[model samples]
Target: MKRAAMVVNPIKIKDMRLLHREVEQVMRRHGWAAPVWHETTIEDPGFGQTQQAISDQVDLVVALGGDGTVRNVSTTLLGSGIPLAILPAGTGNLLARNLGLPIRNRKVALRAALAGRDRAIDTLFVEIDTTGDGVADESAICTVMTGCGLDAEIMASTSERLKARAGWLAYPIAGLRHINARRTPMRIALDDNDFEDERPLTTVLVGNCGRLTGGVRLMPDAEPDDGVLDVLELSAERASWAPLITQVLSASTRTTSQVRHRTAESIRIECEEPTRVEIDGEVHEHALAVRISIKPKSLVVRVPRSSKPS
Candidate 1:
């Protein structure tokens, strides 16, 4: 029987005993050994637990939490060649939803873990220069999109209580109040290009994959394995944002000139003022600059056998 090390975020889980029984029964039916479990704590999310799982040499490592938890476990599992299975929990299950995983059915998700096919996807390596010393003060890994300015503001402002009550809808609800917020001036560089002054923009996002919660395709052309970063910049010369909001609500690839889209292997962004930046869903306050680059097809994840990703 194959072994698995399950890394779980206990805070996101509703019932411990019930989940244990359910997972154990599934393991038996699949002819696999009961998984060795590691729970995430406030201080250490899933990185340490995933490292321990890797050390255990388990056949698989399961991420059972939100996207942040998935990012942590996936980063640790990168280049380890051990496949990852995800059981989506909490508000924005961005990666799980993008991969067409069963978000609400834990049993089916676990079954997919046992029977699904494996596909390798890209992950982003973020270098943050919070103090603007031309040196990276912090580093992070992103399995989903990361952004600055208003986009980061929405993610940072979305409350846990609101998400628990509203699910994916909470994000849009939180975003409504900030639609008219002031834009920030920024200098952006893509790949080998020199930094250029761009219009004061509402937000700048660089994504590994292009799917937001509630069926919004914020970066519709983005592919998780495409080996390129999908970059989005939103600016409005006028104070009103109805057209931009409509574009996002439509979920269409076509966009107005206020919305600019590009693809690159690496992106460097420097803000004129301190801006909030987010890696996955966690916010970093007072980030002056961030450099994002793609680590192409570094994460192997279990996807539905019938699902095909280009």
Candidate 2:
């Protein structure tokens, strides 16, 4: 019998007892006897609880929350080769959707986690210079994407109160509020190639998998295990807003032409002023420089066998 550890986020959806019952039922059906369970807490996210899962030597660590919770657990389980199963309870659930896992309801997601096929995916190492000392002081993130610029600012400014009330729609409401204040001069270099642009970028995103909030396909060709990062650089020039708007509106179903894109094994970004950077939707303040790179096939993640071509 295989041991499984389920790390759940209590704040996400309602009916905890029902979810647990469904998860346990699935585990029993799969011959995973009495899988261990853990819940995320404010005091411990990355280290303490995950280490517990590791000490128990579980075959899998299930993340049952949003992207932030997934990131927290994934960071702890990195390199352990213990596959992660996501049960999306977050507002965006971007990573879950990218993998083609069912997210319409918790029952469906829980079933997929227990029965889905396992696939290896690439993880990114993000280093941020926090002290302006020209040295990276913090590192994190495993799936989806990370970036620093106008988009990071929007992420930093978004209010939790609004998110709890309106779900993912809160992002655009906050975006509308900050749209006029989003311009910045940014220098982006992809593997030593330099490109400088001054625009009110709504956000600049790097995706390992193609989906964004609200099922937006930011990078139509991104593959999580491809050993490369897909960079989507959006610029809001004086006359660029109309087209940019069009792109964003269409992003949920299709790609827009207003965004510039590139793929590289590594990237370096620098900004004139200090800014907030988001890795899988969590915000952090930093001096300017960010180094991102792929850790090709570093993590084992559960995915549907019939998932869309990555």
Candidate 3:
């Protein structure tokens, strides 16, 4: 029987024992051996466990957490030729939603993953500079969206307690509290200065795939394996997100002074003041600037063989 590594976040799961038994039943029915499970910890989320999976030479790795868990697992699995499967267990299962994978159903996701058909997707390599000195204080690989400004603030301000109780609704609650926050003055350069702009922006989102938690298509044209990133720069001067959200929801490409969308292979963002940045759903150390580059076809992800990916 083939082996699999299950990297799970216990906090995201409701009942560990029952979940284990359920997973075992699926493995047995599918002719896969009982999986070697590795639980994610507060100190070490999914990196160490995913690395272990690679060392163990498992047939595939299943990530059973939220976007953060999937991001961490995929970062380590990138370029390893190991296929990754995600079971939506977080507040924003953006990747699974974007890929049309089974959402919030671990059994179905695991079974589909085990069945076959994996796709190669792109990943972002980000270097964040905290000191404004132009040196990267931290670097990591991320799949899905990463950005600064309002999005990061909302992610940071959201209470885990409320998130546990309300799920995606918690983000809207946090957003309402932060709706009046000030925008940051920044300069954005795309493709090594192929195009550049300066403005006070509320949020700058770069997505490998476009689709946020609330069914808002932040970047309507983003494709994970398209070998580029979609950039959305939003600005609102009057402490109002109404106009900005309206523009996004309507899918208008008529760039207003407040909303701009572009496609790039690499991007550099420098802000006048320190800013919080969110990669996937977790907020990272405040950064003065960030540099992001796309790695084409870097990660292989499990998907339904016959289903058309979103």
Candidate 4:
């Protein structure tokens, strides 16, 4: 019999026991042994626990949490050939949204996760170099997307308390505060191209998938299995944000002069000054430079066979 492990974020679900029972029932019905459950702690957000599951040689690993927990567990399981299933439980379940997983209903979501086919997805290998003295380099496997600039600022400004109370609405509330910040300068290089000279940058995002929160399609051409990253850079004055926001909210990908996009296998970016950086909606303090590359078919994810990515 194949064994499974569930890395759950207890804080996100109301009844932990009930959640386990449902997943357990599905596993048993599908010829899987009772799942070994691991709850994420405040300090360790499922990374180490996922590593443990990998070490145990489980046939499948189910992640039940927000994007952060899913990203952490995916990071640990990268290149292991074990399929990771996502059960959306938090505000921004970006991966689940893009994969067309059943996000609203827990029982259905769990069922889809367990019965899904193994889908190989490209993972973003990101390295961020911070500016401060003695600050260590940070790296992770970004599942959906990562960005630097205004998007990172919006995430940084969103308060945890407000996020816990207001959910996704908290992001817009915090974003209103930084809407007028001036664009920062950046030098960027795509693949083998030479560094593009400094330009005022509003935001630069590298995406493994196209969809954002609220069904927004930021990268029209992004695909998880495409073996390349979709790069988008926004350079706009404060006044330009209005139409851009409208285009995004409406899920329109029509090209605008203010936005430049490219599809590349690798990208390197350097900022004129320290700037906030974010991956999979988790914001970091600041970064001076970042190098991003894609590992094609590096992560095995479970997704419904009938679901086609847009």
Candidate 5:
């Protein structure tokens, strides 16, 4: 019998009771035999709870929330070699989509969690290097993408109330509000190459996986276990409403030729002024510089066996 635990965010979606029932039914079907459950509190994220579950020797840990919740679990189980399963209760189920997991029905997600195939996926470690002590201040493991600049600002400015009502579409409204803001120049160094850009950037994203919610393909070539990170620099010059509209049109066809893409083992970003950073859609305070690296095959996640592309 495989012992499993769930770290769920109770406030994610409107149908909490139904979600719980589905999860319980799936566990019974798989003969999990009374699995443990932990609810994530505002004070302590799912990561801390997941750590406790691992310490309790659970064979599998499931994250029952959105992208932020999944990221927290990923950080906790980075090197513990524990496999993670997702119950996509969040607005933007980016990581779940990347894994080719079903998200339309809670029962399907739960069944996949209970009896799905496992695949090794790469995770990104993002660290902020402070100026005063030259020491890193904060760091986290992200399964999807990390970004700074305008996109981060949009994430920061988006109100929880709006998110509760509008879900993932709330981002676009916030993005439009900040579209005309002046761009800040930044210095970018990827692997061994260095470049400077003067245009105000809307967002600079680094992705480990290609699929994003809403069918947006920010990094179409990104592969989760490829041992490399895909970097995308979106400047206001290129990311304006017109270009963005064009990209959205192209993304409908699964084409990313309108967007910029680069792949590297690591990346360094610096700006003349402080910039906000968002990892997996959760915003962080201003930072002068951030270093990101790929932890190849650091996580094992459940995916559909028939979902793998040939």
Candidate 6:
């Protein structure tokens, strides 16, 4: 890359000094100009900094955080024609995991980011009914996946203090505590499909890509560049989750009657009661409904040349 910028989450990195030194050395060795660096704040994770990178006309914008930072940076870079490079530094590096990027070694991650192929990926546009206006208007973009119901509980209940020390393990620990949490009744429709009547649902997930943290593939057929979103629904009783969890933990597509899967360019979901929601692992306020649509091949991402399609 001729010129680039980095948007970092300061709190996630263990040693900023070493990371900066190594990154700078790599850029210099590659004969690239020094990158403009931007740090994420509590108020602004990465949106504003990504905008600044775009305004400065950087060839690439590297996101050095977790899923939330990746989503924000992708939202800002949408339609900008600038490719994003992932240098994961936080727990639940979902996007990087799905993309098959090197997450364990900083050197490999940096090299793959700097000398990788560009892949166009789909993004989801979500309009949430946050105003109680009854109309879905307020919007946001989700780069990995958007979820409601049980998964939201897992994310919301996971203590930040625990997350800081235990990383992605914090989620499941909190989740085990809420195993018997009641399911919400929801009505849903996909693409041109008729709206299904409200029924108790343990979780509803709409994904641009299938993989979750630790190589778990929740939707085997979901493809980021496919121009359609993958929908997975769990409507089983609490007692039935054991086998379902087994399937998920094993990354197996085999599912029973309580599980449903569909593919759509758009989806509309409304719950009988307000329920918490999450986008790219970031919790949002409880909402009674949401409208999600796919924008195919909307963002360009950098991945290792050997990377398979996410």
Model 6 off-target regions past 4 Å?
131-133, 250-255
> In candidate 5, what are the lDDT values of residues 59-99, reduced to their tens digit?
88989888999999888988888899988888788888887
lDDT of each: 0.88, 0.77, 0.88, 0.87, 0.80, 0.86
Off by over 4 Å in 4: 132-136, 249-255
lDDT of 1 at 206: 94
Identify the superior model by lDDT, candidate 1 or candidate 2: 1
What TM-score do all the candidates reach, one by one? 0.96, 0.90, 0.96, 0.94, 0.91, 0.95
lDDT, candidate 3, 1-310, per-residue tens: 7989999999988899999999999999999999999999999999999999999999999999888899989988987898998888988888888888877567888888899698999999989999999999998887999988888999998988999999889998998887678889988999967435568899899889888777777788888899999999888866466787788888776698789899999999998888999988879867899999999999999998765433
90, model 3: CA deviation in Å? 0.8
Which of the two candidates, 2 or 5, achieves a greater lDDT against the reference? 5
Q: Over the stretch 1-310, how does candidate 2's per-residue lDDT look in tens digits?
A: 8878888888874888887788888788878877788888888754667779999999888888888998888788878878888888887787788888777766666666667788988888898886666689888875888867766777777787888899889888877766566555667778767765544454568879887667666777787888899888776755667777677556533445557777898887777777789898888886477888888888888776666632
List, residue by residue over 144-221, the lDDT tens digit for candidate 6: 899988888788888779888887788778888877888799999888788987888899999999987656788888
TM-score, cand. 6 vs. native: 0.95
lDDT of 3 at 97: 86
Error of 4 at 176 (Å): 1.1
Model 3 misplaced regions, further than 4 Å: 194-197, 308-310
Give the least accurate 10-residue stretch of model 4, judged by summed lDDT.
131-140
Ranking by lDDT: 1, 3, 4, 6, 5, 2
Q: For model 5, what is the C-alpha lDDT against the true structure?
A: 0.80
- Give the TM-score comparing model 2 with the true structure, all chains together: 0.90
For candidate 2, what is the lDDT?
A: 0.77
Model 5: CA > 4 A from native: 13-20, 130-133, 193-200, 237-240, 248-259, 308-310
